[model samples]
Target: MPINSSLASLSDMAFGTAFVIYLLAMILSVVFYVKAAGEKPEGAQKFIGMTQSLVWLGIIVHLVSVVTRGLATHRFPFGNLYEYIAMITLFAMVVAAIFMQRREFKPLWPWVLVPVLSLLFLGGKNLYADAAPVVPALQSAWLPIHVSVVASGASIGLISGVASLLYLLRRWQPEGKEKGFFGKLAKPLPGAKRLDLVAYRTAIITVPVFGLGIILGAIWAESAWGRPWNWDPKETFSLITWFLYAAYLHARATSGWQNTKAAWINIVALAAMTFNLFFINLVTSGLHSYAGLN
Candidate 1:
């Protein structure tokens, strides 16, 4: 089916609106951080409420953009890097919305918004593509299943990564005393133990879904290319990242490697996944290269 140019334009406009709303949300969150400093939790309820509202509004708009793009193209929207980034960021925003509803997790919105905005800018400026049907190789029943699972897992992995980074910073700071810039920044975040737990839970969800996505990719490859594995660059990096996450889980459960060590591993896994998403997809030639910037 041909692309619906009208709906395509509407999706683009909605995406732009989502970006603006998210930017506003990030600003409000930062303002909340500043005003809430040295104030009781009860004193800062208004900022939290406003930020959370913007976040939810952004999520709704972002979902409309993704859904309308799919409707316009008559295929899953995440067939290329541009659409994939949008879908992944949408998931990230939804997760952030859920977390921000809790008082303890309210401070995390700005942290999450930075990366989401960065990715959206990257997608809009460098990776934007017109809504259209995917290539023949991507026209399969597994496309939506495989890509959606992978994107969702990746979004959760990002959350886990942010939590680990916050955990490390919080752990490094002296108790009840702010030393410098990093210390003051980490001060508003949840306690290190809570951050570590958040990291662990998010990682647990990421690894299995990510692994399942890989297996589904293999199945799709077998049906499409008449082979189960081709050692594509994306495939290799994805496997490596998966192994890193698995190691993170192992270390988390181990005696000596439970907290700080496992947190470091989780951050590394997130880095690896980010590398695969950009470097392997954009800088390297592979069977998946077609999905790169156009």
Candidate 2:
């Protein structure tokens, strides 16, 4: 078999296997948390051990899938939206796993995965790509540099959003007085205060990385498109996301915008970011239409 073809097949198999493993981790996590709530006699530690191990295993498999795809394409693997989705999600999973190692963030470990899994599912099903030579538009040396950093920044920002969302949903469950299925689930989540800390810290790290990414893109654009900024739909929306995040940080520093309000702003920031990724890249035609969907 051809090397690229063999690698592509292996990538597909790895992607599918990672998805199944993540699903199993989610199930195991649910069981672990339920038992941790003391309703069952079985040890929760064992389940958590299995869940964490499976999570790392899934990450390794997904990493293999991404690396293989890049090898198959004989270029950077981030040329299309399909590839972007898978790789960015891999970054998110890595961040979530690191955060999960913290005791304050441990209980909500599996919850952090719910979004990553969903994105992976979407990527694997709807945005999958076959290995091929990319268009000249994607031939720039910056493909691996600019786009990779941008994707990493975006992935880290996604984790911040997940933490913020969890904070909002479980902000009221501190005393465990709340009664409901979700409430029980929320019981293990870090308190609003802790979640806020993580969200803020994570966002802070992302800001500089994302900003640098935009700047790098500008540099690439200057070389590729004869101008640094074209006000393209993708660029415009990216600016919007950056400013929204800026406003989120600003609001946090200002009066009365701390807690829930700031959380909402971060959520909206994430929403804008997601919209920029899908809608701008897929629905609208522009310079960033490298999604390869058509």
Candidate 3:
């Protein structure tokens, strides 16, 4: 079937609207974080309800945007980088929403929102593609399964990475005083121990999910390319990402590496993931370069 141009336009409009809402939520969350770090804890608490409502609203609109795009294209919505980012941000927002409701994790809301907003902006400005059928390479049944699982893992990895980064910042603070820019940022977030735990627990989930995604991708690759592992840029970076996360988990559970070392490892894995998304997909020519960005 041909693309439903009407629905496609609606989806774009909804996506823009959702982006605005999420941007507002991020701004408010930042305000809350700032106020909480200062002398006005009560003022910070006031923004909590409003920010929460905006997040829920954004998630609903984001879901509509994804669904309408799928309807318009008559296939999975992640046939291109633009749609893939949409789906990834949608899942990230849902996970961030759940975390924001937890007392210990609420203060980290803005950190998570920054990456999501950045990706949304990049998608809208640089990677926007027309509603069309999936490419021949991605027309198989595995597209939905493999892409969705990988996107889901990436979403969770965002949260996990932010937590680990904050853990380092918190640990670096002086014994009694928050002295620097990073210190102030970390001071508003949960304590170092809690942040470490959050990173570890989330990594516990991220490793397996990400590994499974790689396996599924390999299976799909075998069907489409007559080989399971062709060492494509995306595939190679994905393997590196998987190994880094696995190492982070192992370090987290070990005796001497549980805190700073594990946190560093998780942060490195996230960097690898981001590199794969942008540098590998957008810059390198490979089997997975059909990002619709050119």
Can you write out model 3's per-residue Cα lDDT over 245-281, one digit (the tens) per residue?
9999988888866579888999999999999999999
Alpha-carbon TM-score of each model against the true structure: 0.96, 0.94, 0.97
The list of candidate 3 runs beyond 4 A from truth reads: 174-176
Spell out the clash pairs found in candidate 2: none
lDDT of 1 by residue, 1-294 (tens): 888999999999999999999999899999888766554645566887899999899999999999999999988897899999999999988876775577888888888999999999999889998887888888899999999998988999999999998888889984477677776777778788888888889889999999999999999999989998999999999999999998998999898765898899999999999999889988999888866456
- Candidates in order have lDDT scores of 0.88, 0.85, 0.89
In model 2, which runs have C-alpha deviations exceeding 4 angstroms?
Answer: 1-3, 38-42
User: Which candidate number maximizes lDDT?
Assistant: 3
Q: Choose 1 or 2, whichever is better by TM-score.
A: 1
What TM-score should be assigned to candidate 1?
0.96
lDDT of residue 215 for candidate 2: 97
Sorted by TM-score (best first), the order is: 3, 1, 2
What digit string (tens of lDDT, one per residue) describes model 2 on residues 129-229? Answer: 77777888889899999999999899999988888888888776764575677777777666788888888988997788888999999999999999999
